[model samples]
Target: MRPAILAILIGLLAAVAPVAGGATQRASVSVVADLIERAAPGDEIRVPPGVYEGNLVISKPIVLDGNGAAVFDGLGKATVIEVIADGVTIRGCTIRGSGEDVTGEPSAIRVTAANATIDSNTIEDALFGIDLQEAPNAVIRNNTITSKDLDAGRRGDGIRLWWSHGCTVEGNTIRGSRDMVFWYSEDLRITRNTVADSRYGLHFMYSHNTVLEGNDLYDNSVGIYLMYSNGITLRGNRMRNNRGASGYGIGLKDCDDITITGNALLANRVGVYLDNSPSSIGSTGLFESNMIAFNEVGLLATPNTHDNVFTRNAFIENEQPAATHGRGRLVSNTFARDGAGNYWSDYAGFDLDGDGFGDVAYEPRSLFGAMLANEPNLRLFVHSPAQQAIEFTARALPELRPEPTLVDSSPLALPPTIELAIVDSGIGGARMGVLAVALLSAAFGLVAAMGSDRRLTAQHTGGGA
Candidate 1:
């Protein structure tokens, strides 16, 4: 009887243990705004897969997780999510349609506090996708943002951060916006993003210690606009196809201690435009190891901008001059051909010796280039015979040409080449030798056939064979 009683007690205890252990602290609420309002700090709000069409304001630290693919539509009027608290994590939600307004500040998500993580979200059809004001130490990662309103008066931006510092914007795709500006921000890292079809892809105003890397910027009015910013580094970016009335791939205005390297600037109106303000003087910049090709102007260093270095760069196949306004150090650059100078398609000088450097120092600037600089419409005569005649006469008489500025003595090395011998016994060379022998045999057969035909005609006519 005692053994049976002990067995019954053990079975009852096993059955009751699960009920006690499975009792968890759960506060599952389904209402959209009410659930967020009633949730306390450290609470988790699991939003189911549904449409929540209202403005969300989180004032406490919590985790807002979309259980499935949830969406929050702002209906083109107000901001979608406004965060006033720190340490809030919003992830995996679709926020859309915070369109432009003449009266209100329309942004999909706006964060005011710090230590926020906004990741893996889709924001679209908004005046501004994500607007952060005074928010520091935020990680905005893997967000797809697109704003369709890009007219002159619409005033939309994909990601506009004002006075926000220590932000990391990584792996975001921004499109169809205008003037995506970051003003008074510091220690910002924008990397691995695709920004296009906007007025300005990444515009920094009075921002310091910013690093932009591995970004693809194209089809914008300005790829990267820097105004009154300092200590910026732009590396491994590709800027192309920024062609319009007033378009530039990269425009630097009144910025200092900027280092731009390993960038590809292709087919823009002005590849890199260095503008100098009245208050800006003795500001130094470095452009190194960049491929500035097929642009109207590769480097346009306007007057009053001094002490810039363009070193180890490839300026290839520019329509006009390689560089405008000669005030910088151009060192070890490739000019024309596979030589030490740049690979200028219009180089008429000769490389007399076997050394790769050209004999004559190729002056990339010309009088016509300067004339077109003053009157950009004159560039329409680039292919005209009149321009060709001027170029020919200028080559013949150096006195009529513009004064040449020597930038660099040695440029980067050319691409590697492969040589093949026609008569070698190797497979590649033997194949060429076989083709040559076949051609020669066919020629010899044609000659023999003509001689035999003449001999047969003479023999038939009783002439000596």
Candidate 2:
């Protein structure tokens, strides 16, 4: 009877071997978990090539190198990998299948430990790509991240640093996600990252003393927005084609001691929008050597924005070079410092003395610009004859001429020499094609409508005659 029972158990094990050895590979999955349990701290675990089911928690310091062939799939449940141990390194792996429930805040990789290096990982189909909560001194580099196939607003952030300080996020490409945000995370060195096709490319709140250099942010709603963040240095960044509602290439609200230099703000709705920035009295903001070009409004500021210095920058070919949000004067902001002012493409003044500086000051005092400042809907008439008539009437009647929005006392005769190296993500394939078709269709329709309106006006005038 005992031999009969043993024979029955062996037959059951043989029958299940085919299932375990096939697609599920449950034995390899258990082997990894068992090995992790048996390994000591600081062990270098090189996971073999396989699609292992992941709900992994690395609570001890170790180097988990996947060699780029190991894929950890979470089966669309909670976080795939959670690192609670400091000094753990997770790299060279593909991590996916995080739960899509936003309420649970599911993520592919959640690191709550300090000094973790999450590098060169391909993370996709995850709600939140990589979330670092209270994880200081983390190095998140060279990771390609994308969120789940939810709406842009519903998709979680591609990379979020919540109260994580002294972190370096470099050389990462993030797309189709909500934002790459830093909340209360300070002392960050965020450089050389490309973020596109999402909401805010980079959003910072209460994060101070950060240096953002060589970042490319485009095709999004707002390129970079800093709220209540102070002592930030934005240098050598390219912001382009961000034309959503409130599409500012760089926006600063209630921020202080901000330095914006050597950056490119191109083809946005507004190049830069400032609302009470340098909010603290006696605080200073600096804008110099930057190229602000081809935007609807180059610089849009609120009534109370004050004490910002602008020098040696180029403002080129914007519809309105500078304007106020509501009723206010821009005399509070200094357009010239140290005998140098910005270069204005629309400056009608001459360099009579060959000094490379305009003899007359560049003051934007257009009547239509003032009207658009108070009532923004007038922008629909941009580039139309109606806009030209309004400006002509203002020139004919001096009383209609509004005060200058801001004056560049010593405007440069030539555009300032500033170069920004923008990274091409090569991911704007079908979306750009569709956008081009829509823009061409709208332009042709506008031309046809304008021609019909002119013909009708002429016929009505002839009938009255």
Candidate 3:
């Protein structure tokens, strides 16, 4: 008779389970620290599904519902699920091994208090997967944090928000994990995160009024490393590639009021690396309409990084669309603001007032790009023939022009259609027939010295703001 109705429903769930001091609220994996030391204070601790191991210190307001097949294993020795108190959550568990002991800083889910949540968990082979010390109004959402521990110097940050504040780190996916940091946090709201590989896929120090939108930083080594921050707002992010040894699609050091707009900075290696960063003043910082393509130096600003605002940005096919560090000055920074500028795929300049901007002032920088911005190994003789005879002696000796580091004045004979996504950058369809016959014999000797000095009376027409 159906085995006596399955032994009368397993003797009515062992006669109402609850035992407290004796521990038994229907959870398993060997009593899970005696059912969270006899859970109470807003208890819900379901956690059934399997492998529980050790180190679980939940203080109180519990929830820990591992409905997604639990597996909390702290074997690397501690911090598998710390959670001090205040409204804890730790949902859909699978949190794994932590404890690399960088000062006992092990973690899989630490959360030291405040409105905690840490949802959709899957945190893998960790060192520090979701550690939000000094935890404030937390919400580390849609977590997946990983780190098959490939020695990223010593894995310890897939999500670390020390001295945390009003947090909301959303839709996480972080890989490898050396940093997803936001030290000393404040009004945070990081969105749609996806950070990849390791070493900094978002590392803001002294975190300030943040608002990073639609994040997707990839192949990390530096895909967003703002230091000494200020009211930041990097919009519609997508920093990609991120090659190393100083790779960057966002490295602002002494940051202040940053506001990079409509971003895409692809195949990064120095797309937006400012030293003293957009230190705000009047207009309050800006790097509008970005897509500084195929980097090798698209906007390596440094010369005092004065009052920021590099308007309508889109210096495509960058082998150097402007650079500066030392002796590479004169970017008195302000590449056209209202009359509009910025869109230099090596602007040829000739907008005789047809108004899509490009009426002269286009100097886009290059004494061999100021020696690859002060000796970046002169890039293996860029286009040899002695670098096209030093670019035809800096365009027929305009006093060997190499000063105006970024004065676009209205430059853009094409390239700023703005709604940025550009990253094909075949880099001028490749060529090297001896540097294409030394740039076609330096463009027929610069067209026979501009046809004996007539110089074609200014006339550009590729308009398309």
In candidate 1, what residue range of length 10 has the lowest lDDT sum? Answer: 415-424
Q: What are the lDDT scores of the predictions, listed in order?
A: 0.74, 0.90, 0.78
RMSD per model, one decimal? 14.4, 9.6, 20.0
TM-score of structure candidate 1? 0.76
Off by over 4 Å in 1: 1-30, 150-153, 277-283, 323-360, 412-465
What is the per-residue lDDT of model 1 for residues 57-88, given as tens digits with 9 covering 90 to 100?
88899888874367787766688788899988
Model 2, 289-311: lDDT tens digits are 99999999899999888999999
Models 1 onward score TM values of 0.76, 0.85, 0.37
Clashing pairs in 3: 350-460
Cand. 3 TM to true fold: 0.37
Count of backbone collisions in candidate 3: 1
* Better-scoring candidate (TM-score), 1 or 2: 2
Q: Considering every candidate listed, which one attains the maximal lDDT?
A: 2
Model 2: lDDT to the true structure: 0.90
Q: Write the per-residue lDDT of candidate 3 for residues 29-56, one digit (tens) a residue.
A: 3466577678887788886666667778
